[model samples]
Each structure stands twice: as structure tokens, then as C-alpha cells.
Target: MTGSGHISAFSARRAALFALLSGAFLACLALLVSPPPVPEMKSSAIPPPLRADRQVEPSFVHHFGRKHDEATWFKSDFYYPNSGHPAWQADLIHFKKNRVELEVRRRKVAYKNIAGAEYQRRGFYHYGRYEVVMRAAPGSGTVSAMFTHTHGQFGDPHDEIDIEFLGKDLTKMHANYFTNGREHGGIYIPLGFDASKEVHLYAFEWEPGAIRWYVDDRLVHTATPADMAIPQAPGRLMVHLWSGTRDQFNWHGEPTFRNGARARFYCLSYQAAGDDTEQCSDSYTPRKYRR
Candidate 1:
């Protein structure tokens, strides 16, 4: 009887131990099966805004109004750089092998910040006829482009000039002329020559109140003198190239990691467009800059 009682006690103790062990095992298994809760996302901190009237200070007078950073707006092709440069630097992306050879490849890229302040578009610069020569991208929607913008949007209303090419049509390019954001202007031209295959020159003769457009050295579209925006009191100039990858201008649809790559552009020539934005003299029957 004493031995049986001892055996029964041992069995009871084993049962209790087994129960504890099983409970612990089940608890651990449940923990392994469940997923951890995800942490809440944090918002990015915003930067302080620059002062208003002081925006157009001499420190930043000329630049492209189109917002794009050096990396985001432009890439390299031989020597043609995109977007603007710096105040002290001379953005000589225009010349190829020391001569005016505007050739390049323009394809859109994506990035976070495209600040146009540092790379050569903001400062005191005024003068000479400006031209951008290149071929359009092979795809549709948008291809690649170059720009000559000024400090009108950030600072006071200032002069701005642009020579741009779109990828939507291989035979056409766009030109924008403005002073301050108030003076909105642009033109689209269909090239008489084939700019898709070989390189072609996109030229401009910017002389007082007559901003003319040329294709391969031939006059095609002219922005003659009219009471428009350009010819700001004192202005600056910019030279830059870059790519845009937004649905707004993108006809090829937004690029994805899956699609095969494509590029646009071959900037052939670049000439600085100067004081031609002002209202011309009454004696001259200036070409129409606006309707």
C-alpha cells in the first residue's frame, strides 16, 4: 500500500509538470504565429521660406523658371550640361570641342529635389543671341529639353528666354519668351528639315524686341516686337539642359522599371538671346510677339 501511494504521488506530480510544459509550449507557438504591429510613419520636416521682396536680389537674378536640379534636369552628352550653373561659374555647356556644336541625349530621370539655384541660372547676366541645337527623343509624350530661365518666379518679374525640344514629335521644338511670371509666352515650330536622325542647329537672333527662331541657320518662327514681357529693367541669362518625367508632358506614359530604355536630344548649337525682348521703336513694323 505504501509503495502504491508513492507511485500515485509520482504520477500526479508528472501530470502537473506535463500540464505546465504543454501550456508554455502552446503560448510560445501562439507568439510565433502572430505578426508584429507596424510602426506609424513620420512626416518630413519643412524648410523655412525665403523672404519676398528680397527674393529678386542680385545674388539670384537669372535662372530657369522651370524647377529642376542639376542632376534631375540635365545629364551629360559630350559637353552639353542641363539646367543652370552657379553665380561665379561660366556655364559653357554650349560649345562642343570649343565650337558651337549642340548635340546630346535627353531622357527623363526621377529624383526628389530639383533646386535650380546653384548650377548657373541665378545671377546677373545679360546679352547676345541664344540658341539650342539638338534632336528630339525617339519616343512620344516628352523627350528631353534645354532651357534659359530667369529669376522672375522667385524674385521680381525679370526676363526669361528658353529654347526647348520635345520628344513628342521629332520634327518640332518649343520656344518660350517671358519677363516675370506675368508675361506668359511660347511657340511650337515644325522643323522643315529632319532633326530626328542627324544633328541640326536651333538658333535664335535676340535683338531688341525681336526674338527670332531659326532651324539649321534658316529663319522659321519669329517672336517680333510687341508689348509683351521681356526686357526687364536689368536682367540675366541662363544656360541649362535637363529631362522631365512627369505625366503632364510625358506622352510615352510614365516610365517604369520594366520598359526598355530610350533617350532624346543632341544639342548642336547654343547662342545667348539678348535685349530683344523690349518693346521696339514705333518706326519699325516689328514682327508680332503676341496676338
Candidate 2:
């Protein structure tokens, strides 16, 4: 009712009006500049894990007839070839045209009766589908094979996956795997056709829970974790031809080195981690992985 009170009330009303307008202006400005809300992507919209149903194109292809030397791709072993006594030579392994040949012959080396040769890929391989197109050698007591193996070192298990052919009969082959330096999961499958007469695609699909073997793309055998211990360590790919001793005659028969023995490989392809698009860039001596 006094003049000063009237003036104060008018000022307060004016301040409240100004504050209301400023807040409204800021709200409108924010709405004008703000971006629209984006919808979140659903889990189903994302890509799924790679499936094992399809056969991927090989990114790593090896044609044995190339000009590269054995040392460039493989390590020649001087150790004994299984049960037979043979010294491996880098010279005995040959690459010509589209074929790689590993020959076994009798040589008088010191006190050892028989001598043979073996070579393994210089690099290590992890989970992969490995395919080798080749013809097994035909001779009594000779064994030709393609396999993946890791030595037990640093308290690690020695793992091996094998596809072996007995020279006594090319119509049958053996598939086996080992875990922790112990052999297990072995099966002998009778191939309908003579492996020595022609080249066929022999392959193994190594996965986490299962391992499958195929001959010419036909599934010949399957090994599960229930069957035996699966290989967990990475290993080198290997091939060799050797004659076994008399004690091993039950598996490879007597070595009749009449004409000698030779295994020929036309091509070898590997799909890393079941992804055919992956390229192999590992050095000759690949990095070893533990467990």
C-alpha cells in the first residue's frame, strides 16, 4: 500500500516474466539444434558366426612342382622315420611339373639296414581344413603319409593327426590322432579304389569339437571328443616315405625294395580356421602357441 512496496511488487512481477520467456527460448533453441534419436540395432541384425557347412575356397595353395627349394617350405628330418631306420635328405625330395615326389630306397649307411627320407612344413598350423591330392607309393613294407604333428616340449602335449597309406595295399589307408604324447582314435578305412593308381583328394576337417576325414570329398570318418582326446596344440604339416622293420610288418608288411617306393603329391591346399579367405603369412618357423 506504500509507494516503495508498490514499486517492489512491480519489479518482482517483471523479473518473473523475463525469466519465463528466457527459459522457453532456450528450450525451443535446444529442440531446433538437437539431433534425432537413432534406433538401436538388434542382436539378430548382426552377422552370425561362421558355419562349417560350406567348403571355402582355398587361399593357401601348394603345387609341388614349383621352383622353390625344399628348405624354403619344409624341414628335412634326420631322425628315424617311425619304426624304420632312414636318414632324411633334402635332395631326395623333388618338385616337378604338378607333382612332388618322396622316394624311399635301400642304402648301406653305417650299421643301419634301411634308409629313407622325410620332410615337414616349416610353419605351424592351427585349426584348419587340410587337403592333399596324392597317390600313395606301392611296395611291401613301405609307408607313405601326410600328417600334422607337434612335439611335446615345455610340458606341452604332443599332438598328431595322420593319414597314412601302407605300401602293401594302396586300397586301404589309416587315420589316427594323438594327444599328450599318447596315441588314440585310430581307424583303418578301406578305400574302394587303388590309391597308388591315381591321385585323390584326401582331407581332414579339424574343428573344436569334431574331426572329420574325407577321401575325394566323401566323408569317410568322423572323430568326436567322446572318442578320444582332441589335439589342442598347433603343429607342422608333414609327409614322408619309409620302410618299417620286421616287428612292424603286421601294419606295413615286408619291405620289398625291388623297385623302390615313391609317393607323389600333385597339390596341397589349406583353409585356415575354416575360413578359406584367410592367407597364410607365417614364417618358415612359425610362432609356437602353448595350450
Candidate 3:
């Protein structure tokens, strides 16, 4: 009876060991057959082709209100706004009475360190019709400008399209474009009326091969690739108020800040190529040019 009991105990031990080994084998087989999980893809890892469908260009009209739209525009605080000598101060920009005011003040402590204000669109734009309704600042040596500019920030060369007003002459509108930082001589269109006195519609249409400037929807000047290499790079739209030094007297004249100067902007609109929508209406009719 004792021998029979020992045999049964040994048989039970062997069976238990076999069951444990079989369970481990089944687990290993399951792991070998199961599929591996997919790795998460980061947005930066996506290639341009795969991301093209998701990209959208900024195309809209921005009406200046009591406060500047933070989502669509950024007030520049750089030391040199638009590569000019003046230092930009965010506080110099003010919004009141349904328009944006860009102020430029001559510093008494450091007379050379002029304080100016600039605001730029947050998105980069390609070929488009850019427009602004604003009263230019009126002070010799001061410049109130709206333009498109690129500083090689995205592997492109320095290119710019400008609608610049020299406070020295408010009756003349300057139209210029640059490629790779080299200025192609600009033209001065006689506006016949003071740009600083009243709000006017200033616009430029930029295409792949040509550029056209307009004041109150009247064509003032046009340039083609034959005139100069058309800027191919996309850029930001910007407006700034700044003062030039005595060295630029021949161009911008000498800034005399007897009183602080300011430019008032009421609206800005952009229409991309192939878009026919009129984004915004002009607030006032542009004065008839005498010339």
C-alpha cells in the first residue's frame, strides 16, 4: 500500500510540470502570431506632398477696429523695423476710434534713436493684390509704407515690393521693387493731392511676371520682368512708420519731429491669384489726381 501511494504522488508531480510547460509554450505562440502596433507619426515628419492638401493660404480683409487683431497681425518690436535705423516700440502703436495709429517720436535723450511702430501680417503670401486705406504720416524724413518683403527667412532671396511715402513730399507716391537686396530704381507718381491729409486706397497687384500699382483703383504704374526680375519669393505684408537719418536727405529728407508724427490705417485687404472675391470696400473715395 505504501509503494502504490508513492507512485501516484510521483505521477501527479510529473503531470503538473507538463501543464506548466504547455501554458508557457501557448503564450510564446500567441506572441509570435500577433501583429505589432503602428508607431505614431509626428506632424514634422510628414513630407510636403502628403501635407499639401492640408495647407491653406491666408486670404482675407482685415478691418482695423478698436483693437488690432492679434490672430491676424503682429506688432513688431524689433530694433530696426523694416531694416530702417529707427527702433520699434510696441507701445507706439495704438488702436482707437476704429483705426490703427502708428506713432513715431524723436527721443530727446538719444535724438538719433527714433521710436517707431510697425505691424505685419502673420501669414506669408504669394502673388496677390495687396491694398491699404491709410493716411500717410506727414513729417520731413518720416516714411509711412505698406509693402511685401522677404528677408531670405525661408531659403529665398531678399525680395520686396513697396508703396512708400516720403513725408518730404506727400503729393508723390513712390513705387519700388527689389530682388536679392538690390533696388530696381523706383518711380514717383504725382498724386496731385496730399496723402497725409485724407485716407486713400493704395494697392499693388503682384503677378508671376508683372507688377502693377494703383491709387484708388486707377492704374498708376506697371512693371514687367523686362523692367526687372519679378520677385518670386513669398513674403509678409507690412506697414510701418519710421524716420530716416540726415544721410538719406537726398531720398527721405531730414526728419524734423517738432511734434510727434502718426499714420492712421483703416483697412488692409489681400486677394490671392485666381481669386475674384472683393474682400473689402474702400472707406473713402480717393481724391481725383490733377496730373
lDDT per prediction? Answer: 0.41, 0.70, 0.78
**Residue lDDT tens for model 1, 52-169:** 2323322111122323344222322221123222111113233323122222233222221121111233333344454443444344443344444545333446566666555455
lDDT of 3 by residue, 20-74 (tens): 9999999999889975443332333211221233233567888887876666678
* Separate clash counts for every candidate: 44, 1, 0
Per-prediction TM-score, please?
A: 0.45, 0.70, 0.75
Q: Please provide, for model 2 over 79-113, each residue's C-alpha lDDT reduced to its tens digit, 9 standing for 90 to 100.
A: 43233446565666777776778888776444446
> Candidate 1: how large is its RMSD?
13.1
- Which has the greatest lDDT? 3
- Cα-based lDDT at residue 107, candidate 2: 69
Candidate 3 wrongly placed segments (more than 4 Å): 1-56, 81-83, 108-112, 153-155, 282-291
> In what order do the candidates fall by TM-score, top score first?
3, 2, 1
